[model samples]
Target: MVWAIRGATTVSNNDADEILTETQNLLKEMAQKNGLAEDDIISIIFTVTKDLDAAFPAIAARNIGWTSTALMCMNEIDVPGSLKKCIRIMMHVNSDKDKKDIKHVYLNGAKVLRPDLT
Candidate 1:
């Protein structure tokens, strides 16, 4: 089976330190929650709100031992009233487990993305 683990988080600020820490924590949480294996991960896609253009969240993953994982970073569409300074990630993984077993993580201010889940 294949599963997609979706997660969202927000940086404390535009500073590199904040982005790195928040992004790393988010990815780690997602990986842990879903029991993601490094070899099982097909790819990871990340997007940040327009208000945050300073750094790429994927770099945080690489810094935290995701070097072999396929990762991409993008900008979220400019939608009115959307959450600000939010970084979202969608990770695809190949697994033999049932899809319902996977847990998606939504944290910090980005919980607004999926209110019922967080």
Candidate 2:
């Protein structure tokens, strides 16, 4: 079955290094939590708030050896009062795990986006 895993994390600033580091961390956590292998991943879509335009979150995945993965990045809707410097990811994967057993990850200031999941 195909399952989707969600994750989000915040960067301290709009620096490329900061964005890359935080996104890499979030991806690692999501993979670890879901017991996901690169071959299991179908695609990854990343969205970043307007404040975080320093880099593309997909680059972080590539830096971590996800060269062949289908990855894309876009700007998140600029909602009023929404969290800033946040990078969010939705990863689709082929997994046999039950839906209820899937784990979603939210880190740093992005935890507020899904308090119950966090």
Candidate that scores best on lDDT: 2
Taken over the whole model, the C-alpha lDDT of each candidate is 0.87, 0.94
Best model number under TM-score: 2
Off by over 4 Å in 1: none
- Model 2, residue 103: distance off in Å is 0.3
lDDT of 2 by residue, 1-118 (tens): 9999999999888999999999999999999999998999999999999988888889999999998899999999999998988999999999999999999999999999999998
| TM value for model 1 | 0.94
- Which pairs clash in the backbone of model 2? none
* Candidate 1 structure lDDT: 0.87
Off-target runs (Cα >4 Å) in candidate 2 are none
After TM-score superposition, the amount by which residue 59's alpha carbon in candidate 1 deviates from its true location, in angstroms, is 0.5
